[model samples]
Target: SDQRTAWLPAFLAYYNARRPHSALGYQPPASRIPGNNLLQLNS
Candidate 1:
């Protein structure tokens, strides 16, 4: 359980920062954040 807890943050980071969502036009949730570099790179 400790190992799972340790990796959970990494997994959540990837999910919220990298995983694309169809509802978001295939962009990661992080891209919607103000001044996120990811939006500039994608554009």
Candidate 2:
């Protein structure tokens, strides 16, 4: 429980901001959300 609480924020940020998903055309879910910010991935 302690570990989960400690790591949850970091994990959620990664999951929402960095981790790419196939269902999203191999892009991170965050990129799809309406926002001015952009993330660039180097191939």
Candidate 3:
């Protein structure tokens, strides 16, 4: 939905700076969003 998409950047910021991803070994989006690591996908 638009609600989730609209805040993508916001979530990305958090995902990169605050959220700890298990697949990312507790890393954030900054290191898990772009490049070859496409598993951490979003809409």
Which candidate number maximizes TM-score?
2
For model 2, residues 1-43, the per-residue Cα lDDT tens digits are: 9999999999999999899999999899988865754533422
Q: What is the alpha-carbon lDDT of model 3 when measured against the actual structure? A: 0.76
What's model 2's overall lDDT?
0.85
Per-residue CA lDDT of model 3 for 1-43, tens digit only, reads 9999999998777867788888878887566457775665863
Tell how far residue 37 is off in model 1, in angstroms.
Answer: 12
Candidate 2's error at 4, in angstroms? 0.4
Q: What tens digits encode model 1's per-residue C-alpha lDDT throughout 1-43? A: 9999999999999999999999999999887877635466567
Candidates sorted by lDDT, best first: 1, 2, 3
Which candidate wins on lDDT? 1
Give me the overall lDDT of model 1. 0.88
lDDT of 1 at 18: 95
Candidate lDDT (C-alpha), each:
0.88, 0.85, 0.76
TM-score of each: 0.68, 0.76, 0.38
Runs in model 1 lying further than 4 Å from the true structure? 36-43
Ten residues in sequence with the least summed lDDT for candidate 1: 34-43
